[model samples]
Target: MTEPIKIDVWSDIACPWCFIGKRKFEGGVAAFQADADAPEVIVEYHSYELSPDTPVDFEGSEIDFLAEHKGMPAEQLRGMLEQVTGVAAAVGLEYNFDILKHTNTVKAHQLLHYAKAQGIQLQAAERLFSAYFTEGRHLGRAEDLADLGAELGLDRADVLRSLNEDEYLPAVRADQAQAQQFGINGVPFFVIDGKYGVSGAQDPDTFAQVLQQVRSERAEEIPA
Candidate 1:
């Protein structure tokens, strides 16, 4: 049996590009798997807080947060966000920045770690991106996160307890520490087979090409 390829993706819940990248990567994986001989692929999501200092309940709009944190003019930020929203829409994501609740994502990251342990991290990540970007849901608080987890068939009480007790915090920090070791300064970074690193929201063709190249190399490495 061929060994499955492992992909580690580091992203933040608050990052707009991360969500876009997720969709593009999924598209690429689907294309690769369309081939009958394609190798199995396993994806694991890691924690990377884009703005660690952001308040759990920020008291401003998305523009205001970017303006203050990035030290950019609000008008310029608005224009950039508009462009991003357009790109997001092209990928079938309805990003509503107006109602987005900018918040510190440490707790949310912890919830992801918890979900990873439960073997539902992919669904959890998708739900989070949708909640934060499309639904304008609050992700900073434990109650909201637990509710999201419950919707994914995870035990609500256990999810709440995990968040309240900070049970998976160490795991989240470990992922962050690994990210630093990799010299990653951005979200949506993809580590393919732990050998190749693909950065940013690359197109589907790019991801499909990378997977094919990796598969070819792996096949060559086998003994004749």
Candidate 2:
């Protein structure tokens, strides 16, 4: 049997487009699975902090955070957020920008590494995104992350201990370092089969096409 294609994705839980891209990629996977020759895919999410310098408990609205960070006017930032919010909605994601809790995502990224060790990284990623974009849950603190992990059926105390001890910080940093080595300066970057790199929130068809193309090329390289 052929090995499944591996896809490494670098994204941040705080990134709105990453959630949208996740949905689109799922759609693509579903489409690819419908084909008889489609190979299995293994997706691994990497850490990429959109705003590493953001405070753990930012004392302003999402708009204020963006305005201050990007040096854009409040009104202009509002328009940009609205535009991205609409794009998120188009992909069936109910982005609650009104109550979105903007904060540092380092703890959340660390939790992801822990989840990966437990073989539930994808579920952890989904929960984190939903918490951040739709539910307005604060993901900056270790206690909050432990609660989130508990909700996913992970042991609450263990989660808290690991996070408090910063057990997964090195893994998170390694992912970021790898991202830099790959020259990836953006969120939602996709690397397929360690060769092809796809940037941004591309459409479902684009992902499906790339998977098919890679599968075909790899098959040709095998000695029959």
Candidate 3:
């Protein structure tokens, strides 16, 4: 039997490549788990805000957020979005820029905390990403977010009240502090086995190779 490895991923829903990274990482896990010699891998998703200052009710489109944040030309933003969308598509993801909704994800991260309590953090994360990216659903609204919790068997009223009371702010902050401690300056950063750090959404082959390496290292007998 292979030893288990921990994988901590720092990502945000507003990040296009984060979702892409999620898929790629999942593919890597699938490949590694199927390999006869591969080690066990446990994945934990952490929060990282890309647009922490994004307006809750911005009038402009999602692209406007990036342009304003970086002071980049609109044409340049368009080209960047197009290139990102192309990369997302290559990984079997559909990034609908036309219907994208940009908003502050702090509350969404709070909800992820609640979901984590229920052992559904990954599901809640995926729901929020799909809601904003593809479904054009507004996640900035508290009721809208609670609806997701209700679907996940969380108490709707509790979710609403938690949002109203600003719950899980500490967890969010702690994750941010951890990110800073690790010198993580980007989303989709992954840490494997609590010791190995992997930045970005590396190729599946890389994950497979890493899993193998970690397993082998675990098997080495030290001098007593």
Candidate 4:
């Protein structure tokens, strides 16, 4: 029996490009699945905060956050955001920057660890991205995270207890520490099979090609 290819993804709920990259990676997985020689794939998401210093409840728009935190001018930031919004739209993600709520994602990341233990990490991730980017829901608070977990059929009380007690905070920090060990300084970083690192929001074809190469190499390692 062959081992499944492991893909570790590091991303934050507040990251727009991470959501877009997720869609692209899904597309690549689907394309790989089309091949007769494709290997089984296992994907696991890790934690990486794009703005760890962001306040729990940021009092500003997306542009305002960038302008204040990143020192980017409003006019230039607007244009940059518009361009990224268009890119997100290309992959079927409607990025509502107008209603986007910028906040610290520590609780959200903790909730993800809870969801991962329940075997619904992907669902939880998609829910978080939608909540933050499209629905404009707040993800910084324990109650909001518990509510989001409930939406994915996770136990709300348990979610709240976990968040309140900081149950998964260690896991979240571990993921971040590992990211640093890998010298990863950005969100949406893809680590394939514990060796290859693909950074940023790359094209679907790029991921598909890399998967194919990994699969081929694995096949060659087996005894005839």
Candidate 5:
């Protein structure tokens, strides 16, 4: 049996592009899987906090947060967010930035790590992105995270205890350190087979092409 291709995706729950990219990547996977000769693919999500210093409960709109922290004009930020919202919509994601609660994602990242241990990281990632960008759920506090975990059928007490005790904090930090080593300064970065690095929220075609290329290269490396 051929080994499966492992894709390590570095992204944050607060990142709008990450969710869009995820949809595109899934599309690519579907396209690739249509071929009977296609290899198996495994996707793993990693933690990458965009704003580590953000307060757990931030006040004001997304624009206000950017204006205050990034020092960009509110008008420019609004335009950018509008464009992002449109892109997200194109990928079948509804991003409600107006009601988005900008908060520190450290706790959320830790939750992802916890989910990874339980073999449900993919579901956890989707829930978090939806909660943050679409549902406008608060992701910082332990109580809120515990509730979200419960919605996923995870043990609410265990989730709350994990968050409160920071059980997976070390794993989150380790992912961050690895991202730093890779010189990844942005979210939605894709590391394909630990060799090819595809940045940004690329189109489905782009992702499919990359996967095909990787498969071809691997095929050539094997003794015929």
Candidate 6:
């Protein structure tokens, strides 16, 4: 039997497009299955922090971070975020940008690493993204993150201990290094089967097409 098609997606919780892209990717997966006879695709979420150095107790608006990081004027930043908010609403996600708490996701990434050890990494990733993007929850605190982990069947005490002790920092750093080595400079980067690189939050059709192509390529290499 052929192995499942593997998709590695690098994304940040704070990235609005990543949430939108995830919905579209799921749509693609559904479409690909309808068009191909390949085994199911297995998606693995990799950690990427947009604001790696943001303070845990950040104050003021999220616009501040965007203006400083992207070198945009404050008014322009609001305009862009407004555009993205419209796009987000179109995808069935309510995005109240004002409630976004910009904070360091390094520790959140650390919890994701710990979840991987327990074989529920994807669950943890989805939860973290939802907490940050959909619900506007603060992901910087260890207690809140531990609660998220617990919701995903992880041991709450252990997760809390890990967060408090700053465990999994090395793993998060390693993930960042891997992203750099792969030439990824932004969120929502996808690599399929270790050969095809899909940059940015592509459309559902694009993801479907890529999945179909990968399925065909793998089928060609397998013996009948």
Candidate with top TM-score is: 1
Residue range 86-109, candidate 5, lDDT tens digits: 999998999999989999999999
lDDT of 1 at 58: 94
lDDT per residue as tens, model 6, 2-102 = 67888998988878888888877887888788855657789887888887778997887779888877888999999988998888788677777788888
lDDT for each residue of candidate 4 in 142-202, tens digit (9 for 90 to 100): 9999999998998999999999999999999999999999999987999988888999899
- Output the lDDT of residue 9, model 3: 88
The C-alpha local distance difference test score for the whole of candidate 3 amounts to 0.83
Q: Taking the tens digit of each residue's C-alpha lDDT, what string does model 3 give over 64-127?
A: 8778778899999899889988988899887888788788888888898888877989888888
Q: lDDT of all predictions, in order shown?
A: 0.95, 0.94, 0.83, 0.93, 0.95, 0.84
**Residue-pair clashes per candidate:** 0, 0, 0, 0, 0, 0
lDDT of 1 by residue, 172-222 (tens): 999999999999999899999889999999999999999998999999999
Q: lDDT score of model 5?
A: 0.95
Residue 135 of candidate 2: its Cα lDDT? 96
The per-prediction CA RMSD against the true structure, in angstroms, equals: 0.7, 0.9, 1.8, 0.9, 0.9, 1.7
Q: Which candidate, 4 or 6, would have the higher TM-score against the true structure?
A: 4
TM-score of 3: 0.93
Q: Which tens-of-lDDT digit does each residue in 63-154 have in candidate 2? A: 88988888999899889889998999999989888998899999999999999999999999999999999999999999999999999999
Models 1 onward score TM values of: 0.98, 0.98, 0.93, 0.98, 0.98, 0.92
Worst 10 residues of 2 by lDDT: 29-38
Per-residue lDDT, model 3, residue 110, is: 87
Quote the lDDT for 59 in model 4: 95
